[model samples]
Target: MRWPRQVMSLLVVLALLVGPPVALLTVVGPPITGWPTSGQLRAWVQQPLTEQTLTAALTIGAWLIWLMLAYTVALRVLVRLRSTSALLRRLPLPTPLQATASGMAGAAVFGITTNTAAAAPEHSPQPLAAGTTTLHDDAGPGGGESHTIADADGISVADGWIPRDVAMQVSAAASLVWLRRRRNYRPGLTPGDQPGSDLAPLPRTVASVQAALADNPAPPVAPSSYAITRLHDVLPASGIALTGEGALSVGRGLLVTTLLTTQSRPTASLIISNAALISLLGPAARRLIQRLPLTIVESLDEATHHGHPAERRQHTNGPRQAEDTPGVSGHPAVVILDEKDCDGGDLTHLADLSMGTAIIVLGRWPAGPTWHAASSGHLYDPHDLTVPKLRLCVLDHVAAADLLAVITPGEPALGATAAPVEASEPVRPNPRLPRQSTRYRSHLSAADTPRQRLHLRVLGDPQLLIDGEPLTVRRSAGLQILVYLAAVHPTGADAAQLTDAIWPGLPHHALTGRLYTALSDLRTSIRDACGLHVIDHADDRYRLNPAQLAVDLWHLNAALRHATTAITPSAEVWQAVVDAYPADFAEGRAWPWLDPIRETIRRRIIDVCAASAAAEPDPDRALSLLQAGIRIDPYNAALQERANRLLHVLNDDNTDTGIGSPYRR
Candidate 1:
């Protein structure tokens, strides 16, 4: 099947190039009998519009047009070939594999380009269909009021040309798959043993890393293991010197520092000289560094002294063989030094201190491999001409701060406390209770209600419902945007805030188009389903249109708030609160920003269930409530202990009545 398609494509291209010229020569050329000679052409021009001369003129013009068209096609083909060649050259793979991968990449690009061009006309602005209303406003970014559907289509086309990022992501995903297979095949290799084998492509942005982690959700590798940090592609794990000047070098250094410290648990014992820390990492990164597990010393001498006792002893006594000195605490000690504070002598002395330690110098080091960092985050090795230049990950102060904020743990959430429950006490039931209201009623209602209602369910799998019918969101990112907006409801979020929360670590400018496209798609989907606008944008912030949309999370929180503050907390109200929580907030989704919220909500519901169980007067009913609480969180020790105690009480009562206990130990 593949061969047939390939053959047919080749034939079509060949025919296009040759068919018109051949046809002209075979059919039209006989009458003209070849081109006119120089004298004949002058005579024909002087003759003034004879039929024969006009015929000759038309034939020449047609031939010239064909030549120009063919040249243009050839030029485009050449460009595509050159780009493909560059891509192949950059890949760090065997020649055969490189060829195969490059061919696949080329085919994919061609197919995508063809499909996009074909689909362009289909996406062009069409007349409003029956019963459909215009959804988008004419307001433009320049504050103009004359935007048109054609302008939107033009934006889509212009943005379509730069799907290079998508291709890069696809290539990186393939590399990840290969790395996984390699690891599976060679299961015996420890994380530290095969450093070179860890040559998988690294994500270019922090947002990408977060998405990958959320999708996989694996535990961090242990400190004793040699964890590899990504720098665009892969950084050599054996270690190399980084030499550059100004902000670019500093940004790369900060990126490396953050990844090494936080990407895995206890990957290495990191030591940075105080001089390097102050000069290189600015205020934001320094604040983050303070919270990380690393040591900062005044000088390289202090760094060597801070090593393990065995290493210190070895350094004081004499220079042992390289293999004799293990690293600090069985983990490799990574020492970061600045050329300003460190000289050739310091490098020599540190090398003798420990063999397992990796030394990363911030400037030139003649004795070791050195990479020059450029302002654009590309690495160049003058000494190693065989390796191609590669881009490395670089993070500025703002980006680094955002990354730290996301990874760093904060204070314990409210209601997360493990309060003890008294099993012996039986709370008396309230004498009076208030009437129960409808569970899913919207508090925020407008005078002119729309024909349909929009409901967002985040308790379990995120789902959007319109008039009780499920709506399918084609893009995962679009659904995520909606969910995030609902989570931070009425307050809303600006472009920067939204980008940071949804696509963390990426520059807002870089993803501006993507954000706009997703928003447009979301608005279109909502409008198509029920001719009503569900999102409102104002003051550079986007929020759900409160009058039309309702979230289950809002109702759940309201119930909890009432339960906590009530004087004689109604049992029915507490039960309603318990029943409202079908699952954890955004259950089964692991967006990093949603974690704290999810935990807080889960803990609050657990507390409410336990409190409700304590207030029940009947033993059987109280036991049932505790069982329900346990089902929500099996690891809650207080809930577990209370349930066990209640079961014992029930068993004792049954035994006294000479009845067999249904619940046996």
Candidate 2:
């Protein structure tokens, strides 16, 4: 089969190139050819053209035209092959595989079919339609998963797989899409009337997502909903089932259910069977479930009684009172069940419970639409012919933990700690040079001094301030680059490192122009506001100009360094470190690269708070310090234990007196 197709493709190419020229030669190159010689040309032109002469001339003209058309066709085909080859070269694949795929693509373009069957059925969970395009993920380059995309149009090429950073970008883009849709939807607006209806497809790249966000800022939504909405689009009044035994599928289902519940207005609630929660959500269910807006019951019967309390209250108040109840029908109550938990269970009562309630089942259901999720991150909706496939967003355990940590609301700021203490390193007097003349000193100061220092704040909400006045950078990438430079100040990052950080998974060469533009914008913003060149570029590396910028993170690190090295750790130094932590580093921004740095900064500050509390002499002040640390991280076991012990001691002291203890639990 393969040999026949290959042979046919070669024959087609040969026909296009050789067939026309050969036909022209056969008609004009032989002895029977009636073409006039150069010597007879003048005499033939002078004589009136005969019918035979005209016929010969027309025949020659037709053959020439045919040859030119053949050449054009061959040129276009060659151009297509060349472009396809270039695209294949850009893919992150082994040389041999890339070459094989390139050849396959060329053959496909020429109407040569090598093999139509989907290869590696073991990796693909769902059966792909006969002519549908599928991206197969085998053990990719560097032993990671790689995707090879093949379409029904006979275009097969290796498209690179998604990495963690790209995954986060995709998630963020999905959330933005969801938010935009939600914001633009009105009571009677049709799909065409909705805002962003004519917009391009959802952005799959980091740069595109950033650009989209800049153009239309994503409206804020519940943090849990924000995370879950990334997984899939949840229909408000539809029943959907996810059928797959894979962890990714199960997790996606759970997250989608959680998202629906969180989006429920007034007070969100969920009725998930106990078995489903324990078996499907696994060991960490208890901890995570506590934070989610849901309720666990033994069975569906108990769920019925617990569901829609607000609706029940309305019915009791009066028939007319139902109209006044907010969020009664605005958000659908969600019920999630596992196949094992709902074996032979009756779901008919679900309809009787409430209108617009969404039901999500983890496994096969006898009713409603079901989607199958593959381990390769493809979600297949066999029932929907129009849109049969989608890239399913999945969060692994670590990513889920990161999202939860980010969304967990920090306690309100305890009144400011002691004023920030300057680093204890004695300020060395300026080197005593020969004293300048008064006139020279005045001239030098007037020529070189900056009006105000540029302050770069990355801790808490990222902000750029000049003399304490906030400055807004319109370009998100520009601000991100500035923050990155501040984080890695002095040493700086080269172009490659910067590009990888700012636009992860994108080609560095392709992004060079955009990177230059962002860098320029950042420089212009700083220069225009403070008349200072804050970003320094040298030896192809970019860094913040130390003389022109003051970074809060730098100050925090300085205080921490001094506090750690002191002979007797000073409480004041530790307090300075605690005071310096306004919030988590780059809080509210979910840049994937910033996660590790944010966590590191957070843990360091928590340690400092604990150290400060330990160094305090007074019990009251010690408790206060511990509380401050607790406010920073409520889930920190050490801080909670310390605070509990201190509280107990104070409670005992007060109990010994006639007065009662206000601190008693």
Candidate 3:
């Protein structure tokens, strides 16, 4: 009963195979003498065979062999039927009644044609006459012809099937083999089937798209010097944030970064109702379409045409295939519906049915019919473990630039181009805002005069000292650029020098956009934090305004320079210099450019300490300064000797010669 369908199929095949043979045996065997009757056959099978009854045993063995052959045929038919059923599922089929009627009519027509052909069939073969060639459809290269024609329908039929009777026979044999051996047909047992795997999250698919976009070559234009350090704070993971006028660029950059950094790139369907928004995306968006595996369609008509036209037309009156609909196919990981006119109907039909698909709605602010206190503008699913509904991200100017860079890869983002600086003009205050301008005056003085001065501390950890308060820069490139400009001083460094210092290994041309961004970020940070713009540019070189602020490193060097001209520099002056330079220049930072400056500061400190020690009258005090110099520059041989001499003067117990002097180079 458990395998009744299989059993019945097997029986039908067996009946066909065995019925004719058994009928012939029953009819013909009776005429022949010594034919085994049912009673005699049963008695022979029941008893053990003896030498005297060997003839009856042989006859009974032959009949058993025939039955075995019949059973084998039956099993082959069952296997063939199973295969047919599987194939039928993949094919488009007519209604049951229609198919049955067609099959019956075709069978009747085939029978008539076969009978008519048989009645006219007798024909003699003729040899080809000289100078004439016969073209046979099945002729071999050897000129031999095949007598039988292959079925025309057979050519159209898919292969991989055994005849019903043959398949049945094979199945029966397979079953017999399995039962008899009680072991696997192959060397090892078949492995257990694993459960079906779940589809990957849609975000993964989007990320892949984002990556492809990022890898592409950018457009011809270059990005402007626009920077915002706190982009990440405004746009967090898994939700949308609104950005105002100034933050647009930042928002756009974050969007692109988010798209690329997100773990998954699921299939996404973008529905945009506003044509203007699409146009505004420009080349970058166009490039993204070309790069990502995205399908863009506006209306239902376009969706209907996704699959075969004939299939769509045939099912126009009924429910269409899920695949025929854009997002429903599940090929896309997410659906982006940007329709200005998107309503409850669209959401109910498209987004709701989309279910597992992530739906990102754009432009339309108000909720449709689906919006409820519980729905929260997003249709919730019990299975959805991600953020609710669509994440609304605002793409600002900077964000757009980032998106452009990603989508185009090598292209400059929109609005990134810098205005051409006039060749004749040197770097000066902005003409748009004169020194007397109220806003400019306001920035200069919090009250009557500017409350904040340009305060830079680069002796230790580099920081922007604004009004005696240290302000840390979030962007490392900006900080590095600022430090380099400060180190070079009034003369500053050209674009080439800055490029070499900032990005040593990158190609010069590729650094333009990045350099612009760094400069912009530095300027922005300085303006916002210190309420001053100390950086000035001229002849393609950059420098910091010394008049506007003071730097510790600059002061240390200035003091040292003055000390050389003085008749006799006081100990206090030397001490001040030593104390002013607390740590190595650009300490805690690891940059090749910082190495020389850091070493220079170290050497200056050692010299100052050594000179101060030599001038001191007290032997113990002189030894202390010498020891300080030795500690500052352990590799300085001259400083080491000074320390040794001081130790001798002090008459220290450990003043013995060459006892592993700490200052030995």
Candidate 4:
């Protein structure tokens, strides 16, 4: 066994066995390039025997063997390299046996490689690329404020909105289909919530306010970001609170925002969150948002649907009725909202889609850096901007409860706030007043003051004011009929007059029932009238005890008489006149058959002004009174001429005996 002899022996042995299979692989593997790929090969092995893969492979193998045989001697040398031992063993056997063995072996190797691939784990799946975010994908039911949201493309709409955010993908796809065929819908919210709407409906939202907690809101966003509005119930939670106007400033790093169901009036509030409260100070900011003809983007799909077509059309660009405003946010405030600037949903969606899911308009965004507007309709481009990450807050119910006190103000809640007492004179309690237990309470605010004060907050129409505020009343006809009684208090109107005033449209018995309800509701809504009863109610009439309540008209009459009787009136007399007339006495407020009473008060005010002009000690003071009367009744030629004549006479040192003079007239 010399080295040369060993090499020689090994080559001859290797050539005989390895040569053939190496040759077979070279011949077979290349042609299969145009055939099944590695992935396809793997799938073939998993199928039943009759599948195309098994049949195709067998046919290809036989064809290769025939071609090899056609060049038998030329191929035999190539096969010698693949498997020397097997090739050697088959070469000596019958030719049919050798060919069959070679083909079978090649087919087996191909199948083995493919089957191994089939068993391996799946190949890496590519990550999703960008530019595909959409509103249809992002918004859906239960798609409100959430712990985490995917929003690379503003409003990642693909995630179908639901209580849980798992179906986003299917939702995204479905939204595309739905959006093409339908209009987006934003629910409407009235500016002032009515007395009882949400009470009976089962809540649809998962209770929120967790979003306002520490470490609860989504991580703070970057500067100059947008924040969307969100929906919340009257749950017991109030997030961060900033009070006063200066508390909202850009320098202090706060955003100016507001919420409102009513359009012109926004509740005072500021959003402390991940959003830019963009203020339009110059042409730049204006250019971005103000492309008006005062454009409004109302969803008109309702127009293309059923129901009263006329009733559904919105006349006002924003909310026409205060009660019908989409007063969407938690603690609603006054805000200048641009509907076109925002997305499809109302205020709530505006919160969720922007910086952090919170916004406020009226209350005040804690005063931030201030800027002066050089011109009207100024706008600012946000790119040249920076601000601290707004700390978002979700106000819990406690804060809402406190704010509620301010929004709805009262000593005894300007309307129906008290329960009634027993006997009209005895003033027995009605037992329905929120917390009062005393059987009888004073009608005058405190211990028997000479005058009574009434504060009203009118919710229906912005009509007249006895004081410079809204007038209050119960929704009852009989109780309101008492207004006429008091308007003529001290010299009270007769009972037959009272019956005709209240029961003009009622059956006789209806008067009793209506009166009872009116009296009961009024006692609950008005100031206390201790030991105050309808005395002399037996024969179609009733009168309030004159001492029970201080009547405005009574006070006015007293002031008038005092002024008229005093000659050479002092400043004190003028002060009495000023104090008597607080504001325009109850302007547009009235109930059934109460027009005459209203007219009487209206006339009295005019008369009192006329008398005061004549009674003032200083000619200038008299001129001022005459001028005020003229302003109140611009069309009154007599008042206008009288005022002019008075001023002219005063300027002339009262020497003129002009016929048109206020004194002569």
> In model 2, which regions exceed 4 Å deviation?
1-451, 488-490, 504-510, 657-664
lDDT of each: 0.56, 0.56, 0.45, 0.35
Badly placed stretches (over 4 Å) of model 4 are: 1-473, 489-496, 503-510, 524-540, 592-595, 611-619, 646-665
TM-score for each model: 0.51, 0.44, 0.33, 0.27
TM-score, candidate 3, is: 0.33
Q: What is the Cα root-mean-square deviation between model 4 and the actual structure?
A: 35.3
The backbone clash count of each candidate, in order, is 1, 0, 47, 105
| Cα error, candidate 1, residue 112 (Å) | 17
Candidate 4, 220-302: lDDT as tens digits: 23222222133222100211222332222311211111221111233222322112223312223223223211122233122
lDDT of 1 at 328: 35
Candidate 2 Cα deviation (angstroms), residue 617: 4.4
Which 10-residue span in candidate 4 carries the lowest summed lDDT?
Answer: 201-210
Model 2 C-alpha lDDT per residue in residues 1-665, reported as the tens digit of each score = 59999899889977867776676677655323556788678767777597766766777686768768787877998998998899776543433544676677677755633445444545635443333334433221212121223322221211212322233344553444433433332322343563433122222232323332332232322121222323323432445567664434445434533443353233334568776676555676676556455668777676666665554454343553443332244434556777665566666666455655556667776655677765434456776756535443344443343333222222111112212112223112232233333321222245676778788898889999988989878567777788877674345578887776665545666668777877777667776676777666656677666656788888788777888889888767777788888888788875535543554466567767777777788888899888887787666656777889999988888878866777754
Winner on TM-score (3 vs 4): 3
- RMSD for each of the candidates: 20.2, 21.5, 36.8, 35.3
